[model samples]
Target: MQSQWGIMHGTHTTPVGRVRDGALDLLKWLALLSMVLDHLRYVGLSLDGLYVPGRLAFPWFCLAIAANLHRTRNAVVTGHWRYLGWLLLFSVISEVPYRMFIDDADTLNVLPTLALGLLVARGWQQKALIDRGLALIALILGAVFSSQLMFGFFGVLLPLAMLLVFRRPWYFSVLPGWVCVAANQWQILLNSGSVVALTGLVACLIAPLAGLMLLQYAKNVSPPAMRRWAYALYPLHFLLLLLLRKALA
Candidate 1:
């Protein structure tokens, strides 16, 4: 009999030894769709329900980061600078559009949180002086100015936590999810948050676990590839949404 954990090994095989995980790709597409729906709420849609699904977007993205790190562990030896560089560049590129698209977005866009999280994840893996130093500095900056960060320090730490528990059981996500809840303003939301807010909050907590389940369970589903072009979609979506908002307004 085949093992139950067969999905972890992936479905599609390549001669080059790299297996393309259709489930992972599907999760990415779902994440993208959720993000778009969340952003649409701001584009003059009275779709408050979108917020619930939107909550899944960030955590799923973080899980993707952790998954990518696990898949490309080899990059640790060969400098992950290119990965950092791309994120950093897009962080800069996305800022203006993010500010323009979102109302009063005083915080820096989400990419910085992700970039720092990547560094933190890497540090967790190797704990090298350089990796730890960079992660430390980024963490300090995010902590000192948490308000100016999209997800704040704890949000930046989430991906690293996810990375640490990448291969662990799905329930392990709850451990790091507390940090996620706190980073997402749990104190304020917990008391007065409505049904939607509370549901979204719960979704935020479980998104990683859910995403991991999708990766390890959903088999034989091929979603489109989300490659370098997908990075451009971040800023492009902001622009497109801003245009739509202008039209709707």
Candidate 2:
């Protein structure tokens, strides 16, 4: 049945032998690093140059979502729900810290956008009616609240775009690569005319493909597993950074 869906949907959902892929762990760790680096700019440091690497964070995170969904396409229904529940839970738990650390935050923390992206990607990968309906609702909400979404509607679409090109050739990843740029607000970056902003624009453009290469060729490279508890890191990092900012002040 799963194979049938794979064929009909033109997805590479073949179940693998391993319980976890190390490449994915590596990707997660790198994404975490990129995120931390990005947030460091807010940590009372004059590290505006970090913005270029920070541009890599969101797309890499989205690629992680797509990679996980692609690999676990055959997992039990409850597992999928559990995955989403964790994101939703952390979205709420992380918001206060996110707002605290990010000065004048206009949007919610990045988790809510990731949660919606997950639903949209799952809708594309799963044949279940519930999945499709949830994706539709996610899309509507993303559209209605795009201004409130961290990366806006393009960010919501990024996971699905990554999933679409997950198993395809590396060139195919350019689709999501462009989406990553848009999600990062390439226009504003371009118009800024700063060297750092332009560098960030280029980083966003290639972040997805860079991540895909890591996933494809780095399977043997082991890293720590990024489990459900890792969700806490999202909020905890903000608190730690906020404290650092206070100390620096």
Q: What do the candidate models score in CA lDDT, each in turn? A: 0.79, 0.86
Error of 2 at 173 (Å): 1.0
lDDT per residue (tens digit) for residues 1-249 in model 2? 111122114345455435788988899999999999999999887999999998888998998888778777775567778889999999999999999898899999999999999999999899889999999999999999999999999999999999988556567777998888888878888899999999998898888878877776687887888887899999999999999999999
Q: Report, for all candidates in order, the number of backbone clashes.
A: 0, 0
Candidate 1 displacement at residue 128 in angstroms: 2.9
Question: Which has the greatest lDDT?
Answer: 2
Q: What would the TM-scores of all predictions be? A: 0.89, 0.92
For model 1 the TM-score comes to 0.89
